[model samples]
Target: MRIRQRCGERARKRADRGPSGLSLLPWLLMGLGALSHLLGGQAPNPWIGAAGLLAFNTVYIAIVFRAFDRSRRESPLTWGLLVTLGLLTFGLAIGYGREWLLLFPLLGLGVGAVVRRGRLLPLIAFPLVVAVGAVTFWRDGWGSIGIVYGTFISIMVTAAILALDETVRELRETREELARAAVEKERLRFSRDLHDLLGHTLSVIVVKSEVVRRLAPRDLDAALAQVADIESVGRQALTEIREAVTGYREGSLATELDRARDALSTAGIEPVVRRSGPLLAPQTEALLSWVVRESATNAVRHSGASRCEIALSGSADRVRLTVTDDGRGPADGTPGSGLRGLRERVAAAGGTLDSGPAPRGGFRVTAELPVEASVPPEGDPAR
Candidate 1:
């Protein structure tokens, strides 16, 4: 029962790994060859020779299985057994006939598949086995037919097994590369979220902290209230950070617009926001909210403009957000990392974001998102 369970687990693992059925073909053919030998009355002691054939093929299958297990160290004992089996099969073929000679080259091929260091051995061993069979049969009155058949079978089997092995190795390497790419993608996402979340939150904290410092001596109560607000904002930032880590945090377009206005006011800039069209889907709204936050943050911190205008208007199938600030346009002809990261995010959501100097003056950030992207997933709580 334990052996059966182990076999079942192995089968499941093989299925999970890849379409590895090709590797089994060689073993099935070898088994069929053994069965043919037995049925054809080629062995003098049929039962004993059949048992020997089974034992050799079993060892050959084991060696092939070991080739796939990189974690397990290659056992020298296994290679020694292969050598011993090949010699024994050669002796049997010399005493009996050419049919037993096939097993000798088969043993060498199994060894070659497992032994990564001695790749040349199988090349030499297969041809030698064929040469020996040809010489023995030619001397025994059997002619070129025996030599050609032995050579063809030995070379074909060895080549087929090695080809299959190489294919499996390439597939495994490709899977590993894909896994690494997935990990890198996840890391980028984490960094982007942390930056978007903390950048705005920290900027607000700095502004409010400055407000408290200014009011501390002149207005004690107002300073104390500002300190309290700081504490509340810090706590909220902590909650949002935690949610962002778990990928559950959602944003609101209305909330972001209000915060953007407040942040602009604190920075001594006038913020004008206008919205039109029906309400957006939750995810789309959240993404647009992030745009507002990022735009407001950049306007306050980078752009030295005194006035910023944000316009949101689109049809039933689309939403457009245009943020324009009359600031010194592009500096050194490079967009900031914040905008670059935002571009990636927008693109992932099947949207387009264009940011550059406005023709009339200042800088402009315009984003257009599909209306369908706003729709929540079927089972989403927000839906």
Candidate 2:
């Protein structure tokens, strides 16, 4: 069983790999010649058989070699002549009682599996040749019944091995696809987190830098304080971004709300946040926090709105979060990169997010998460 399994594994690997046709043909021709010689009788008048064997082997070998040589420079004609010679050798082998000629079809099948690029002509031709050989053997009573049975088994086994090889190939392809998907998911997550971190921080820095520039000639103290605030905000942002980059960033709705308020305030926008939901599932909360940060950043950087509203609500089956700004809406009716990243993050958490111009001339982002966090019983805050 171990040997059979090992053979099957090797066959599968070979089928997955490409063929070396030139190298294979010589071995096949040599095997056919040896089989023919073995079955040739040793009688005194066996010169005719020997002569026929030698002529046929030489022709077959020449044809196979020519086929290999021309495969790079010639067309179907070379393969056609080689196959014809192979058929002639098959006939000679059977006529001389050469049971080893059975290797032809087996080798053909193996070669077909190796060179899987083109149409399956070799595969079909080999099986048909084997069928023809079997019929001839039955008719001529050349070999014993056991030989016929063995031939049938060999054909079946080859077919089974080829099928197994194809299955293994498909499985490998599936595994590769799954691995690619995993990598893509990680990339999306990293992009989303980076966007959220940098977008908010950069917007706040821009706003503070503008204030410092404008106030510098009028109020030196105020300008210096604003510059210091910028430095502090920049340091905090860098630390948080580093944590996110290192995969140590944890989500908290309260922390996100505070960050949102500070970011909007820096942009001279008032933020109103209302929360009435059950504590969210960790995944949902993480996604929602990203959405909050991204939406606030877009409002500060792109939307010219003066006020933004954030609301959260939950029920037994779902949770909903909405962020709205009373700023100038998108000119082209297209969500920007920040909003697009938010949508992807929400969708990955089995949620849906939509962002578009609100009817009242601002932008609106609404997301719904399907899973709800389990809440403790009333008055059981510790739980």
Candidate 3:
């Protein structure tokens, strides 16, 4: 499965590079023209005319293939080569038949595909080539009207090929730009997850280390127990980190509350948790859990507070969670990276998040999510 996916991606990347097989289109059209000429009527010297037509086709094919190549296109040498081919084909047609004149306009079309410096050259040159063919047919007085109509038809065909080539070029550019944007978005998500995971875990470990330092001299047994708890927390943090790397980790409000209480206790701060109203959906519960964990981590790591409070409440239409601590708030009112990411997450869930200093003291983070907001629809992955 993985191999197939990789192969499919490689194919798509190749397609996104540019249009393929463009050089063959001109030859295909020329082949049809040759078949039509052969079946139209008898010729004075069919073998000689066929040899001359084959030689013209060889030159036309080379010019067209080179015109489509981005590296050599639009060079002074390339346009000069096209002009030479056009004159040669026109001279050959004068001796062979009016049919050979049709090949001349193709040279103009190929040059127009590249060398945008002379944008009007093909429009001007094609009509002149058509007039020359029409005049030649007039001199012979055989199917004169048909010659005029065929000239215009050839011009239309050339115009369609040029337009298609341009559209393909634009599509390739847009595809590459979209791929770049997707990669940048994934990088941002991974960085945000790593910061949140490691930040909270490391903060808890620091607080527990402080507890061990204080208890070791007074109560060796108690300090040993704290060390054991620290070791356990470290192992759990490692497991969570691994899960986070694979994007399979899920947060729970209940689990965050338990860990927050333990972290507060280790930091010598009291924890008070309260929940009310109906239960929340799993997604909402997970979102709130992250908010609580981040808020609690900030309270323990930054704010020198003695108490922290966590509250969860739900109404018929909305669920709200708030984390508050009795500690000095942000000196400049600017939120940290975790809170910024939390705001984005909550908004994606059709929710709102607010954070600032409490009216009394310290910092407060609040989140409210719509209870009735339906899960993301089928084919619409979660944000």
Give the runs in model 3 whose Cα sits over 4 Å from its true position: 1-100, 103-162, 372-383
Compute the lDDT for candidate 1: 0.71
Which pairs in model 2 have colliding backbones? Answer: 305-327
lDDT of 2 by residue, 230-303 (tens): 99889988888778666667667788889899879877999999999576666667667777888888888888
Regions of model 2 farther than 4 Å from truth: 1-94, 98-146, 149-153, 156-185, 215-224, 373-383
Ranking by lDDT: 3, 1, 2
Instruction: State each model's CA lDDT, in order.
Output: 0.71, 0.66, 0.71
TM-score of each: 0.60, 0.67, 0.67
lDDT tens digits, residue span 1-383, model 3: 99999999999886655443364454447445544676675545666667766666666666666766657655676667676666666665566565555554564455455443345756755666566665557544565555545545555555466557667777878997988977776667667767777898899999888989999999999999989998989999998878766666677778889999999888888999999978777777777778888888888888888999998888988998888889886656778988998788788778899999998988899999987444332101122
Question: Each model's number of backbone clashes?
Answer: 1, 1, 0
On the 0 to 100 scale, the lDDT of residue 191 in model 3 is 72
Clashing pairs in 1: 281-374
